[model samples]
Each structure stands twice: as C-alpha cells, then as structure tokens.
Target: GERAASAAARAEAAAATADARARGDAEVLARLKVSEAEAELRGARERLAELAGVEMQRQALATELSGLKAGQEERDRAHAAELARLGETFSGLAGKALEAAQAKLAENAEAVLARHREAAGQNLEANRNSLAELIAPMRETLVKYETRLGEVEQARSEAYGGLKEQLAAVASGQRLVSEEAAKLVSALRSSGKTSGSWGEQQLRNTLEMAGLREGMDFTLQAHQAGEAGGRRPDAIINLPGGRQLIVDSKCSLNDYLAAVEAPGEAERLAALKRHAAAVRGHARGLAEKAYWNEFGAAADFVVMFIPGENFLSAAMEHDLALLAWAFDQRILLAGPINLLALAKTVALVWRQEKLADEAREIGKLGADLHAAIATMADHLGGVGRNLGQAVGSYNEFVGSLERNVLPKARRFTEMGVERGKKAVAALPAVDAAVRPVAARELLAPPADDAAA
Candidate 1:
C-alpha cells in the first residue's frame, strides 16, 4: 500500500508539470497575438492620418474654387450694373437731343419762310405803287397810248405770274434740301458696310485736313494676315518712332440712326439705349483685338472714329462715363473733331521728328567739317615746322661758307691765283623765320601739363 501511494504521488507530480508547461505555452502564444494586434493598430492609425490629410487637401481646393467663383460673380454683378447705368443715361440724352434738334429745325424753317414771304410782299407792293403812278401819268399824257398801256398791263401780269412760280420753286428747293439731308443720313445708316465706308471717307478727309499723307503718314484699310483671323484696321497711322496707331471706322451706327428716326419718345429712348450698348460692344471687341499686342510697336489704345460729332455727343450726353469706360478698354472714342485734333497732333509730332533728324544731320556735317579743318591745320603746322627747319639749315650753311670756305677762297684770290672773271656769289644768312601756327588746337600742350 505504501508503494502504491508513492507511485500515485509521482504520477500527480508529472501531471502538474505538464499542466504548467501548457499554461506557459498558451501565455506565449497570447503575447505574440497581442504584439501582432498592436502592430496592426499602428498601421491602421497611419492610414487614417493619411486619409485625413487627403480630405483636408480636397477641402482646401474646394474653398479656393469657391473664392474664385465668388470673385467672378462679383465682377459680373458690377459689369451688369455699369451697363444698366450707361443705358439709362444714354436714353435721357437721346431724348433731349432729339427734342432740341426738332424744335430748332421747326423754328428755322418758319423764320426762313416768313422772311421770304415778307420780302416778296414788300416788293410786290412797291411795284404796284410804281406802276399805278406811271399809268396815271401816261393816261394824262395821251388816250392813243391806251393800246400800249394794255400791252404793258399784260406784260406785267405775266411777270407777276413768273415771280409767283419762282417763289414756289424756291420753297420746293428748300424742302428738297431738307429731304436730301435726311436721305443722306439714312444712307449712312443703311448697312454696316456703307457706314464703314462713310466713316473711312470721313477719316480720310480729316487726315488730309491734318496734312497727313496717305501711305506715308497713314495707311488706309491696313490688313495684316495672322493665324487667328488677321487684323484689318480702317487706318494705321505711322508714328514718328516706327510706331503705329490703329483706327477702326467700322463702328455700328444702326442704333444711332434708329434713335434719330424713332417715331415716339419711348422708341427713341430704347433705340438710344441700344446705341450705347452697341458702342460698348464695339469697345469690348476692340479691346479683345489688342492691336497693340499684334503690332509690336503699336500704341496701347486704338482709336474708334465716329464720323459725326453729333453721334458721339449723343451717346456721351447720356453716359457721362463713356469716354472713361472706353479708355479703360484700351479704346479712344473719337468724333470728327476729336480725331482731327489728334491727327493734327500726330502731324506736328512728325514735323518735329523731321526737324530733329535734320538737326542731327546738320550736327554730323558740322562735326565732319571740324574734323577736316583740324586735319588740315595739323598738316599746315607740319609744313610750317619743316619750313622753319629749312630756314635754320640755310642760315647755318651761309654762316659756315662765310666764315670758313669763302674767306679761304678769297685769300686764294688775293694770292694771285688765276680764276674766272665771275666771283663767288655772296651767301647771306637767312633772317626770316617760319610763321608759327595761330590755332590753339594745332599747338601742343606742355608735356608736363599734359601728364598732369
């Protein structure tokens, strides 16, 4: 029984040992799984942080885009407001101009007709009085002159009839003149092409008046071919420094014409509003063309020439800011008078440039002439020095002959040497000295002073 108990205790101890080993193995496995879980957690945390950064970048981009959109909307609103203001202003001006023009026309027409009628009546009355006085005298003079009086009366009636006809013709001519003027205005507004041609013609006339020569000072219908549809400015004015000034004469006048011919005040106002819009549209178009960019040496602003002062004034009357606005678009709105003045200024600039060129040429000529004179003086100085040297040499030779050779030769002649009857010519020392150069440029400065 003792042995069995001891064996049982040993078996229990072995079982206990196996159980502890199993527990330790389970703990190690659990520790390895926990470490793997911690690593996965750290990796997940990094991925989450990367996702947050991506979301932040997206939000930032969206915010920037929103800001840009808001800015664009603001600009659009301001532009729309400006356009509305311009329209309202133009409408009021158009109405006033139209009313004033109509009233003036009516007043002038009435005054002219009244004056003519008064003059005709006064002349007729005077003639009638003179005829009556003459007839009375004739009737008193002779009854046989009654036949001649009848003939005279018939002739006077025919003359009066002719005079009435002439008055009617004059009235008709005046009406015709007014009609013709309206027709001419209408013709100018008939089509874009016609308006453009007329504007160009007016521009040419103005330029000519400003003394600008075509092809030299200015070119008409200048066409420059390009990849993007080429630019064809109505006129390209040549500036002094090989620069250009573009002028576009294709300004739309249809709306302006409509405003002029509108039957009612409301229609006229609407037409004038349209006219202002058209002008703005044209200015915008010119700005887009950017002629200055195309022509390397072109002026920044292009001239938009309106053929009539009234056309420009009518538009500007309502929209006070029209000129400033156009200028902002790199366009200058020029009427006939304004364009004429600008052209005159350009002509003056050209004249001044020509004078400058002539002055430069004169200066160059003067410099060349001075250089030539300096060179001639230098040669003359050299010749003077050489002459001085020759004079000195001649004097030295004369002294040597007189003191050494000529005296010995004379002694020989005294010693009774038979010689020719002709005696040796007496050599005299030269007294004259070469004249020094008078010019300061020819005279050299002292060597020490020059070094200093």
Candidate 2:
C-alpha cells in the first residue's frame, strides 16, 4: 500500500510539471502573434499615408480640369463671333461688280473662315485632349490610393495590437517604480533623517565637503585665545576688509523638530528663545572680534551668517529681538541674499578704489594736457606775430612802388599821348587825298568852324 501511494504522488508531480511547461509554451506563442501583428500594422500605416497624399493631389487636378473647361467655352464663343463678322463682311462685298469681286470675296471669306475654324478647333481639341489625358493618369492615381488605403487598414490593426502590449508593459513598469519609491520614502522617514536635523546636517556637510580648511578663508573648530574667559566661536569667516565674522551652526532641529513632534504654545516659545539666544551669542562674539577692523577699519559693523536661510526666517518670525540684539552689538545678521549683498558691497568698494585711482591718473593727465596746450598756444602766438609782420612788410613794399614809381610812369604816358595827338592831326591830310574834291572842300571848311 505504501509503494502504491508513493508512485501515485510521483505521477501527480510529473503531470503538474508537464502542465506548467505547456502554459509557458502557450504564452510564448501569444507573444509571437502580437509581434507579427505589429509588423503588419506598421506596413499598413505607411501605405495609408501614401494613399491620402495622392488623393489630395487628385482632388487638386480635378479642380484644374474645371478651370480648363471654362477657358475652352470662352474660346469657342470668341471664335464663333469672329466667324459671323467675317461672313457678314463678305456678303456686303459681294454686291460690288468688280472683275474679281466674287473671287476676292469668296477667297477672303474662305481665308477668314479657315483661320477662325482652325483656331477654335485647335483650342477645343487641345482642351479635350488634355482632359482625356488627365483621366487615365487620375484613374491610375485613384487606384493606387485605394490600394494604399487598404494596406493602411491592415497596418492599423497590427499597430493596435502592438500598442496594447506596449501600454501593458508601461503600466507594469510604472507600478514597480511607484512601489519602490514609496518604500524608499518610508525608509527615509523611518531613519529620522528626514526631519529638520537632516537639512542642517546636509548644509553643514555641504560646506565641509567643499574642503573648508582651517586658516585659509575660514576656520572651523578654532579655539579662542583666552584660557578660560571668552567663548570659542564655532566658525570664523575672514572677510575681504580685514573683517572677521563668526557663524554658529545652531541646529534648531532639537527645538524646531520637537515642536513639530509635540505641538504646544510653550514649546514654541521655548524653541524661539533658544534659537534667538544662539544667534545673539554668536553676534556678541562677532562684535568682540572687531571683524570690521580687518579691512583697514573701513567697515563699521560685522556680519553674523546663520548659513541656514530657514533658521534665519524662523528666528525673524519668532522674535525680532534677536536682530535687535545683533544690532546693539554692531553685528549684522545675514541670510544668503543678505550675504550676497554684502559680498557685492565689498566688491563695489574695491571697484570704487580702482575708480578713484583712475580718476587721480586722469587728473594728472588733464594737468599735463593743460601744460601742453599752453606751450602750443605760445608757439601759435609767435607764429601769428611773424605772419602779421610779413603781411605788414608786403603792404609797405606795394605802397612804396605805388607812390614812387607810379607818377614817373604817368609822366612818360603823357609824353606818348602828345606824340599820338600829332599823328592824329596828320591823318586828316592822308584822308583828303583819297576823298572826293567836294568832300575835301567841306572838310576844310568844317575845321575852321570847329576852331570857332
């Protein structure tokens, strides 16, 4: 009986294994079918696109055909009018009995009719031919488009199958990611590191991770010089203007986080006081260090960097007394924006110094230019004086020539004038010989009357 039972159990186990193997094979076959369907769908979609584009072109060609038909009708109407006019004109001319009248009329009418018929017929035939030629190509295009549409339908079905598979896969992936993310969030909260303490730790770690070494631009964990009198600040930042600032990383996580865990008016008040005291204490240290004196005693106040903007906000919200206390100590409280402003102010100071130096140099240059201008003015004045003397000398020389030489030239000119007068008197005798006897007698009588 025991052997029989053992054999039956073995047979049952073997049957179960066979059933599982068959199920796996069935799933594989289903996946293969889906993949094949997808490929067919893709091919169909491509063919459908081709068909749609070609169908659009066919519609445009049909529109063009309508326009061509209208043009043909207009041409036919014009040709008919021309033919009618030619026939009327020929009939009117046929009444003339000239020798070649009939022949001429018939010939002219036939020529005009032939030209009109040829033009009309050629235009009509060309339009008809064009329309006919378009028909076969358009039909072929339509056939191709229909074939492509059929192909697209098949491709669409295949695409739908693949889309289903893809959607399922994406759903599965999203579900897995959501589950993992939830778990990670749960773990993070469970570790107690997700609280405000974590943020403080992160901020401090970030600063430390930047390789903030001691005795460079900053000093972390630096001790005070006093043996047992003063407080040793947490971190000291050396500013550009010989100013030193003390920053206290007062992780208000203990108070703030506690207030969150246990909400009460008293707890909040206590947390506020603790944070203010922490900042105030750091402020007092900053004032004592006289960090403002580091930059040639230029700055009148020192800065107290809270590092955490949230902490600064909480402090300001809780009690403005913290800021007041800092002010009393000549300590300026700064968050990130205020800190950046302070840095910019420092940069502006340096820029102002550079500008001042440049201004001084410019002043010197202006003085040098003034001296050069004076020298140039002196030389220009000398040149002007020399030019004036040259002008004066030229005027005097021209005056001397006009005064001394002009009268002598005038006397010589008068002598030549007198000789010319005598020559003019001889001109009358020469004219007398060429003149008629009566004219000469009149001229001699006129000379006596002229003298009188």
Candidate 3:
C-alpha cells in the first residue's frame, strides 16, 4: 500500500510539471541565442531524463508490490492445504487408536470369561469330590446300624425262647431236685464236719471262679465278737477305699428239697413258703449282727450268698418279697449270677484305679521329659558352636593340605614315592554312617538306673 501511494504522488508531480513546461516552452524556444538555445535544450533533456527515471521507479514499485501479493496468496493456500492434511492424518490416527483399544478390550473380556468358566468347572468338581468323601463315612455308619438292628432282633427271639424254657423247667422241678436233694442231705446229716467244711469249700470255689484271690480279696471265717465270734462268716470281701463287703453262706436247701419233693400240691406250696421264710430269717440274723461295726471299715450291708441257684430260685418264686425284705435289713441276696457280676465290677474298679495311677505317673514323666528336652537343647547349642569351630579347623587343615602339603608331596612323587589313587580321591569327603541311631537305644533304661 505505501509503494502504490508513493507511485501516485510521483505521477501527479510529473503531470503538473509537464503542463507548466508545455505552456512556457514556445516563448523560451523563440527568444533563445544559439548558445542559450543549446543550454535550454540540454535543460529540457535533463527534465525528460528525470521524468523517465521517476516513471521507471514507479514501475519497479508496482512490480515488487504485485510479486509480494502473489507470494502472500501462495503462502496462504499452502498453509490451508497443510492444515487440511494434518487434520486428515490426526483423524486416521484417532480412528486406528479407537479400533485397537476396542480389540484389546474384547480380547481381555474373552480371556476373563474363559478363566472364570474353567474355575467354575474346577470348583464344581472339587465340590462333588468333597461331598463324596463326606458321605462315605455316613453311609458306612448307616450300614453298621442296620446290621446291629438285625442282630438285636435275633437276640430278642433267643431271649424269648430262653424265658419259655425257664418257665417250663420251674413247672417240672421234682425230677431235677430229687437227686440233688438226696446227695446234699446225706452229706449234711452224716457229719457236721462234712457239712460245715464242704459248705465253706463250695463258697470258696464260687469266689475263686469269679476271679477272687484268697487272701488279697477276701478273708476266711472272719470271727466277730459275741456268739457270732465262734460262728464265722464265709468271707470278708475287700472293696476299694479300705472298705469291706461281707459275704455269709446260708444253705436252706433242705427245705427247698422238701418243697420240691412234697407229695401234694398244697404241701409243695406250704414247703416253698417255709423255705422263703427260712431264707429271710437267715438274712435278718446276719443283719442284726451289724457286721459293719465289727469290721470297722465295712459297708452298712452284708451279702447273703446261697451256694445253690436252684434253692434260691425256688424261694424267690414262692415269696417275691423275700429279696426285698432281706435288702431292707441291710442284707444283699446273691446267687452265683449276682456274685459273678459283683466280682467283674470290682475288677473294673481296680483297672480304673490303675489307669488313674498311670496317668499321674505319665504327667510326672512328661514334666521330666520337658526338663530333659530343655537341658538337651542347651547342650545341643554348645555342641553346635563346637562343631562350627571344628568345621572351621577342618577346612583350614584341608586348605593347608591342598596348598602346602600336596605340593610337597608332589616333589616326593618326583623322587619315586607314590600315593594311592583311592586315598587321594577319598580325602575330600566325610563318612555317611553318622546319621541315625536305633529307637531301642533312645528308650533304653539308663545303665546306672538298671543296675540300681
């Protein structure tokens, strides 16, 4: 814009100068001498030359301005094209990034889904295996219960049969009692010695069969004060806690035999009643003695034992209250069956007592073992430190042998002295026999204790 304005101002000035020169040119031309005319022409030529120079300057300015405008237009077009290309490039890059992101997200989703499905399958299998393991024991237990139910049913049938047989035997007692009655009666009547001795012998036999020791578990004919002193009890059975359970043998088999061999039904019933009364009378006599006071540490009851089960059974059948009446008098009635059960219970008590004592001993042993372990651990720590020192010394010795001794030995070999190949190879390793010892040795009684 400044160049155009300067060109316009130069044209206006040239036109004004041309107009004044045209108006004054004829006057100046007519009045001039040759010399003056020549000078005037030179002046006119100079003005013309100045005008041409001005016009050339105006043209140069116009050309430069036009070139600048064209260059500006070309640059604007190029910048727009470059911006459009950049936009297209950016759009392509964004589209590719979005596609890649979507593909990666899809792959991750598939991998996660696959992993979860596999894990679910594994969990289902594990659950099935666990359920199977859990159910196996329960199934076995159910089978065992079912088998036991069958056994119980069988036992019930056998018990009912046994009950029927017992009832039948009771109904037909004469044949069974006649022979046993004769032998026992003849034995008692012939001699009182045979009677007392054999009766006591019979009692002892039953006790022994029930696992009683003679002196350890019972005493023979333990005499008390008064008339009962001369009359001895069969045994004083020892119980736990320093207490005694007294047993007295009473045989009313004669009355029972009489009842069995009675001629008529009424006589048999009367005899049975007498026999039951006699048994109760004996229990009453034993209780009146109050043997618990005599033994000092005895229980408040006595055991009335009948050597014959048949005699006792007959009496019990005649009078159901006989046993109850005896018990009320601080007396316990016992046949062979009851005595055996009592003995077994006593044996069980002894076993439990032994177990309790062993438990106490084990507790003491455990405390001692703990103390021993603590001492052993202290000893082991000392041993470990000593072993570390020994190992360090061994390593030093080996290093000396390798660095110093073997080199000297090599020189000896040059002098024709030889070393065995096996010995040389064996020097680097230790023996393998030092690992373990026998449990017998570990648990063996100490030599000093054994000797003592």
Candidate 4:
C-alpha cells in the first residue's frame, strides 16, 4: 500500500510540472528546459517499473497466504467433526458402564434384603413364642421350689427331735464315765472305726492338695481293653511322650488297726508282724500284675500308694528289708509325702519336654526362613543380570541407528521447494482438506468419565 501511494504522488507531481512548463513556454525558455523535463520523466518511468515488480511479488505472497488460510479453515472443520464423533462414542460407552454398575448394585441390594428379611422372619417367631411361654416355666419352677422347701423343713424338724434324744443319752453317759474311761472310748473308736473308705478318701484329698488335674494329668482309673486283658489300676498319671505312671490306692492297714487294739505286748508284736506281712503281700500282688508290659510307654516300675503316713512308717520300722525287697520286685512304696514329691518331679519333667519340642519347632522355622532368604537373593541376582543384558542390547541398537540409518536417509532441508508448491514435502497440499488424527485420540476419555 505504501509503494502504491508513493507512485501515485510522483505521477501527480509530474502532471503538474507539464502544465506549468506549457504555460511558461514564451517560445524561448520552454524550448531550453524541455530536455531536462524529458530526463526527469524518464527517471519517473524507471521508478514506476521498480514499483510494479514489487507489486507482483506482493501479489504472489498474498496468493500463498490465501491458500494457507483456506487449508487451515478446512482442517478446523474436520477436527470439529472428528471431535463430535468421539464425544458421541464416549457418551455411549459411559452410558453402558453406568447401566452395568447400576444392575450389579441392584442385584446385590436385593440379595441383602432377602437375607435380612429371612433372618427377621426366623427371629420373629422365636420372639413371639418366648413372650407367650416366658411366665409358664417361672410358675412351674416356683411350685417345685416350694415342694423342696417343705421337704427341707420336715428334715430339719426330724433332726431337732434326734438331737434332743442324743442330748439325754449324753447326759446319762457323762454321769457314769470317768476320765480314763473317756480315753479308752476314744482309742476304741479310732482303731475299730478305721476302714478302706477312710484310706481312699485320704488318698483323694492328698491328690487334690498336690494340684493334679483330673483326665489330662491323671486318669481316675487306668483301664483299657487290650490283648493283655483288662487290668484296672487305681489311677494313671500322664507323662509326656505318651509315657504313663500307675498309682494304686489300696493299701492293707487292717492288721495295723488290729495291732493298735491289742491288749498285751506279745499280741501287739504279733499283730505288727502281720501288718508288715500284709503290706509286703500287697506289694507282691502289684508286682505280679506287672502293669508295665501292657502299656506302650510305661516305666519299668509301678507305684503302690500307702494312704496313711503312720501305717507306712509303722510297717517300714517293723521290717528293715521291706523297702529293698519291694524295689527288687519293681514296686515303689509311696506315702503321702513321697507321692507329693513325685508329682513335683513329674511337673518338672513335663516342662523340660515342652521346651525341647519348642526348640525343635524353632529350628524348623529358622531353616525355612534361611531357605526363603537364599531364594530371594538368587532371584535378585538373576534380575540384575537381566537388566545388564537389556542395557547392552539397547546400546547396541542406539549405535546402529546413529552410525548407519540416520546418515543415509534424505531430509526435508535439502529439497528447498518454493512457496505455492504443488505439495507439502511428500504430501499433496490439497489432500489436507480433512486432516487425520490418531485412533488413540478418538478413544480419549471424556472429562466427566475421567473424573469418575
């Protein structure tokens, strides 16, 4: 535009010069200035030609610009259409996904409701029955308690009547008895009243005091049907590793009681001898049974428990050879004190066995842990080797590309195609009426779906 304006201004100035020269031509001065005017006119014509060439170059640039603008507008339209298609497809996929989620949620909700309703139905009947029957059992139990109360009242009344009769008898006896007579009565009661029940009761009480649990630590009666036949020991003490120790509660103390009640020193000595013999006989009987061979893990000996300390001591004091003789027959004589000591020793043995088992388990666990660590180290070493191999391969491929492929391929800078060429490099410019996009872009997620 500026060049055109300058050309127009110069042309106007030349026309005005011509008019002035024609008017001033008094036939003398006009003829002399004519050559100079012709020279100026010639210079003006040369400037006009230069301006025209510049205008031609400007027209070519304008044509190229118009073509580029047309192609850009066409590509924009194609991009909009592609984007619209992608948006529609995404909306369809999102709608299907939402429907599937809703369907799954509905199915789970129905299943949960069904389960809740079924549980409610089951409990409702139970609750109704409980409400109806709750008072009936209470009334029945109350009547039964009242009956038992009457029986207890009747028993108390009978006991009071018996006590009144016993008080009268005691008053009579007190008037007749002396102090020496009282002492003799007490002695008679102790010696004659002694029985197996007393001894057994004492044995059970001592066992309870020794802190042994029934069933697990000791079985009440050790009897099992086996090829050796059924031989029931009084009790079996459980030991670790399936081992067992037999305990017999029955010890004969009748002859000892007889000796205590003897009137003369000779009779008492004979009865004491008999008591010692009775104990030896019982020990022999236990040895003859030899319960050890019947059990899979029983010890070589069996324990014969004397229920009373005095009875055991009296027999042992009377016969010096009893303990050694019993030991030779595999019968261990244990009084109350000795039995308690044996229980403590067994408890210690159990603890040692438990520790040994724990050590075995810990050793196995350590071995397993060591194996796992070694396996993990092996895997890590293999991974390091694989990574080194991968790096080597990658460097080799990169060297091949740089040293061989890139140097030989033709590049765009060498072409030097002019503006408004028939094509853009290898592609035709007109073919870009609709620009292409990647398939991945067509599958791009929507904004709302992406957030979800």
Candidate 5:
C-alpha cells in the first residue's frame, strides 16, 4: 500500500506540475491579450482626441476669417472715401498749377515784348543820330554857300557910281570870298565840318580863353615848309621866350569815317589797316622833319598830336604794331589828355625859365655883395689905424701940457697976482710955438702922426 501511495504521489506531483505549466501559459496568453486590448483602446482614444482637435481648429479658423472679412470691408469703405477726397484735392492743385503757369507765361511774354520794344527804340535812335551826323556837314556847307552868294548879290545890287563905294563893295566881296575859301580849305583838310581842324581850333580857343595873345608874346601858324626836301609839320608855335614847338596834327578823318561806315567785316578791316598806315606814315614824316628844331632846335622831339581821342584809341586798338613803329622813330603821340598835359608842361617850363633868370640875377647880386664886403674890409682897416693914432696923440698932448706948463702955472699962482700977470705975459711965445706945432701935427696923415 505504501508503494501504491508513492506512485500516486509522483503522478499527482507530475500532473500538478503540468497543470502549473498550463496555468503559466494561459496567464501569459491572457497578459498578451490584455496588452493588445490596452494598445487598441489607446489608439482609438488617440484617434478620437485627434478628431476633436481638428474640429476645434476648423472652428477657430472660421472665426478668424469672419473677423478678417469685417475688417477688410471697413478698410475698403475708408479707402474709397480717401481716394475720392484725394482726387478732388489733386484736381484743385492741378488747376492752381495751370493758372500759375499761365500767369508766369503771360508775364514773361510781356517782359520779352518790352525788351524788344526798348531794343528797337535804341536801334532807331542810333540810326537817326548816325544819319543826322552824316547830313550835318552838307547842310552847313549849303548854308555857308548860300550866305556867301546872298552877300555877293547884295554887294552887286548896292554898288554906287562913286569910286570909293564901288571899291569898298569890291573889297568886301573879295574879303567874303577869301574867308569862305579859307573855310572850305579847312573843311577839306579836316575832312569834317568843324570851323577849323579840331586840333587847331581847340588849341586856339584854349589859348585865347586863357588870355593868351599872339604876336605880343608868341605866333601860331599852320604852314608847310621845305621846298621839296624836308617834311612840313602841321603847326609852328613860337613862344615869347624865343622858344618854338612843332605840333603836327595827325588825324585821318577819311580812314576813320570809312571804317565807321563800312558795312562788312572785310571792308572795315581794310579801312582800319588804311587808317593805321596813314597814321604811321604821318608819324614817320613828323620824325623826319624833326620839327622840334624850329626854335633853335631846343626841344627834344616832334609831338604827334592827335585831334581826337577816338582816333588815337581806334588806331591803337586796331594795330599796336603802329605804336611800336611810332616809338622807334622818336615820334611822340598825344591824345586830348596828353595835349592838356603838354600845355601844362609848357606853362611849368615857362615858370622854370623865370626861376632860372632869377637865379642868374641872384648870382650877380652875390658877386656884387662880395666886392662890397672886400672894399668895406679895406676901409675898416684904415679907420682902425687912424683911431689908434688919434688915441696916442691925445695922450701925448696931455703929457706935454702937464710937464711943460703946470710947474710954471703953479709958481705964478704962489707969487700972487703980480707974478701971475708976469708969467701970463711970458706965455705968448710958448703959445705961438706950441700952436704952430699942433697945427702941423693935425695936417699930417695918421701914419705920419704915429711916426712923429
């Protein structure tokens, strides 16, 4: 029975072990199923949560879109109103800009018209002046001729049978004719309508107005010298102090007028060159003349005096080469200012000459003074010697009186009136001899007196 019990126990233990093994396998399978169910549940929950989150996001986006649409509508309305206002403002600004532009254009147009009118008026005035200047000479010449003709007609009509009256009328006509001819010659030489050539007239007028008289102190003339060899200067002015100056009026009115009237560049240039050449030729002629030699040849050089400043300026402007040429030949050119300066220089020279004369007189006076001083010195030496001799004779006379007469006079006085009378009676002989000696001493020279 115990053996049977052991077998049973062993079987029971084996079955229990197999049952435990089956229970373990079933537990593992159950745990695996639970884990798989837990996994599926967690996945389903996660899907459900994802759906909820997606629905929430969609709703939030719809809310945001609704807000954005409302804001966009408001912005559209504000932008439309602002755009309308901006259009109106821009239209007003454009209108103002157009008005301002039109006003400025009108103002500029008026200014341009005014400038054009002013320029035209100035041009017209210039043309008129030029024309008048051209016509003036002809008009003057015509008037002069008419006057002369009228005077001649009058003389012929008024002539009488008397010889004196007829001769007088003839002389008058001749004088008129000569005067007119001289005027014509002047006009021709100057190529202008001036009474005298401008320079000559100005010089004459200035001198006259300054109280200068010709022939009393000086002589002025326009003369041509040199038979056929030397040059003839324009004017020879002789001064009071035996001084002479040559003033050559070098002005080419023809060339200057031609240049002024030339309408084209080529003509103007040619005229200018001609003027320069004429001026240079005149300058050379003046240099050759050495006209300064007229007054003892005292002056240094010839003065090339231009009548008009314009002529000198134009010549210099056109060609400075002529200036160099003039200088090379010892020709001195002078314009109006230079002419005035020269006159003043001449005045100063006159004053200087006077001063020189005074200086010479002073020199003579100094020599005379020196001679007088020498003579006075000789006279003073003689006087001093005489004075010394006089002083010596006076002292000697006092000594002689004291020594020869005092003791006798004293003895006579001591003897009383009778003896004194007797002494006085004896004094006549002594007085006679001493008076003669004193007279002889007075008749001699001081030098003789000193010797005695």
Candidate 6:
C-alpha cells in the first residue's frame, strides 16, 4: 500500500508538469498569431494609402482633361466668330463699292451728255461753213466759164454744152451720194441682222481709217472653240507683242429706233429706258462669255461697238449708270468716235514698235561698220610701215654706190684705162618717205598695255 501511494503521488506530479508545459506552448503560439495579425493590419493600411494616391492621380487627370476640352471649345467659338466677321466685312465692302459707282455715274451723266451734244453742234456748223466756202469757189468758176462762152458763142458752142453737162452730172452724183447715206441709215433701223451688219461694216471702216489691215492687223468673225460650244467675236484686233483685243458689234438698235419714232414725249422716254435696259442686258451677256479667259493674251475688257453715237447717247440719257455698269462687267461701250480713237492709238503703238525694230537693226549695222573700219585702218598702218622700210633701204643703197662704186669708176677714168667720151651717169637717192596712217584707232594704245 505504501509503495502504491508513492507511485501515485509521483504520477500526479508528472501529470501537473505536463499540463503546465502544454499551457506555456499554447501562450507562445497565441503570441505568434497576434504578431501575424498586427503585420496583416499594417499591410492593409499601406494598401489603402496607395489606393488613395491612385484616386488623387485619377482626379487630377480628369481635371486636366476637362480643362483641355473647355479650351478647345473656346478656340472653336473664336474661330467661327472670326470667320463670320470676315464674311460680313467682305459683303459690306462690295456693297459700298457698288453704291459709290452708281452715285458717280448719276452725277456725271447729264453734264457729259450735254457737252457731247454741244460738240456735235459745233462740228455740224463747221462742216456747213466749209461746204459754203467750197461752193463759193465753184460758183465763181462757173460764172467765168459762162462769160467766156458768151464771148465766143458760135465757135465754142459744143464745148460749152459739154461743160454744162459735166456740171449737171456732178450735181446729180452729189445728190445720189446723199440719198444713199439716208438709205443706209434707214436700213440700220430695219432689222437686227441688218443692224448688226451695219455695225460691223462701220467697225471695218473705222479700222481702215486707222490704217489697220484686215488679215494682218485684225480678223473679222473669228471663231473660237470653248467648253460650252464656240464663240464668234465680230473682230479680233492684233496688238503688238502677239496680244489680242476682241470687239463685238451685236448691240441691238431696235429700242433706240422705236424711241426716235415714238409720237409722244412719254412714249419716247419709256422707249429710251427700255433701250438702256437692253444695253445693260447685252453687257451682262458679254461678261458671262469671259472672252479674256478663253484667249491666252487678250485684253481684260471686250469692246461693245455701237454703230451710232445717237444710240449710245440716248441710252445714257435714260440710264446714267450705263457706262459704269458696262465697265463693271468688263465690257467697254464704244461708239463710232470712241472706237476710232482706240484704233488710232493701237496703230500708233504698232508704228512705235516698228520704229524700235528699225533702231535695233541700225545699231547692229553701226557696230559691224565700226569693226570693218578698224580692220582697214590696221591694214593701212602695216602698208605704211613697209613703205618706210623700203625708203630707208633705198637711201642705204644710194650711199653705198656713191662711196664704194662711183669713186673707183672715177679713178679708172682719171687713169685713162680706156678712152671713152660718154660720162658715168650718177644715180639719185630717194628722199621721199611713206605717209603715216593718221587714224586714231591705229595709233591708240593696245587693249592690254603689258601685251604691247
């Protein structure tokens, strides 16, 4: 029993010790797990801090993107406003130009037309005065002839009759010429085709008067192909340096003729207004053709030829802006007088060009002639030097003969080697020298002094 109690006590002690060791091991493991949890919490806090920094960066990027988008929108608005302002400014300028042109035309129309009419009246008066002067001389001559015929009536009766017939025929011819002119004026007012032909004929006459040839200086009814179809200009005048000037003679005269024939003043005024409108219409049509674009070197403006000055004057009287409008359209409204002046100017330009060509040719010939003269002078100088050398040689030969040969011959004569009555003839030395060349070109210093 005692042994049993002792073993039991020992076993109890062992159990208690084992239990304490297990408790210590469990505390150590709990401490280790607590350390691990604390480290995990620290890691979680660091990850949260990183996420906050990313959120801040994302917000900054969004703010920057929004600012860029707003700036872009502002710039687009400014660009659009600028474009609108420029368009408005352009429109205003165009309107102002047109208004100014119209105003200027209105102010000048009446004064210009009045001046033209007054000039026409003066020209008519001058022509009449000239005609009267011519007729007065003819009248005096006829009177003298009449007196002479009466004095020798029987002998010169047939001659007097012939003279009378000749005078009558001349008067008849003058009347015929006047009638033909009237007929031509009437025909011009008859139809469009006739009127166009008349205008072209007048243009031809004006060109001839200006001394422009048909084929050489100008062409009639020239046909040019175009994208639309083809264009036929009435006349294409050749300018200097291969430039061209187009002239159209298709201006209508029907409205102007109607105005002239109108019975009442109101009707005449209405017809004149219509005439002006027709002219404007024609100018617009010509502008659309863009003849300058078709020709490589054509004048910017096309000439619109009106056969009659009256027609143009009447149109301008109603519509003061007719000329200004035509100018805007790049169409020049030229009456007979205006066209003649233009033609004359062109002819003068051609003459000036011809004179320039002739001057160039003359200058070239002068240069060539100068070179030839220089060559001749050089040759003449050479000939002079040769002549001088020959003269010097002749003098030396004469001296040698007098000193050596003549003295020996005279000594032989003195010795009486042979008795001869004929004396030895003395030869004369040449004293003349060749004349030097006097030309300045030959005597001048060499082009390169070192070479000389």
The reply for model 6, stretches above 4 Å from the true place, is 1-186, 228-230, 400-426, 437-442, 445-452
Off by over 4 Å in 3: 1-181, 189-193, 223-231, 385-452
lDDT of 5 by residue, 265-311 (tens): 89988998888777888888778766555435435666687777888
lDDT: which is higher, 1 or 2? 1
Q: What TM-score do all the candidates reach, one by one?
A: 0.58, 0.33, 0.44, 0.45, 0.42, 0.54
lDDT winner, 2 or 3: 3
lDDT of each: 0.75, 0.57, 0.69, 0.68, 0.62, 0.75
Better of 4 and 6 by TM-score: 6
- 96-183, model 4: which lDDT tens digit per residue? 7655655665566556656655665555555445434644444554554455446445544564777889999998878668665656
Candidate 2 lDDT (Cα, 0 to 1): 0.57
Model 4: residue 238 alpha-carbon error in angstroms? 3.1
lDDT, candidate 6, 3-65, per-residue tens: 355445545544554564477654433333333333333433444554456556556655665
Per-candidate total of colliding backbone pairs:
1, 7, 0, 0, 0, 0
Q: How close is candidate 5 to the true structure, as a TM-score?
A: 0.42
Q: Over 4 Å off in model 4, which ranges?
A: 1-212, 226-229, 257-271, 408-410, 416-452
Question: Comparing candidate 5 with candidate 6, which one achieves the higher lDDT?
Answer: 6
Between candidates 2 and 3, the TM-score winner: 3
The pairs that clash in candidate 6 are none
Candidate with best TM-score: 1
Best-to-worst ranking by TM-score? 1, 6, 4, 3, 5, 2
* TM-score pick, better of 3 and 6: 6
Candidate 3: lDDT of 70?
68
Name the regions of candidate 5 deviating beyond 4 angstroms.
1-196, 205-219, 222-245, 261-270, 287-300, 409-452
What clash pairs does model 5 have? Answer: none
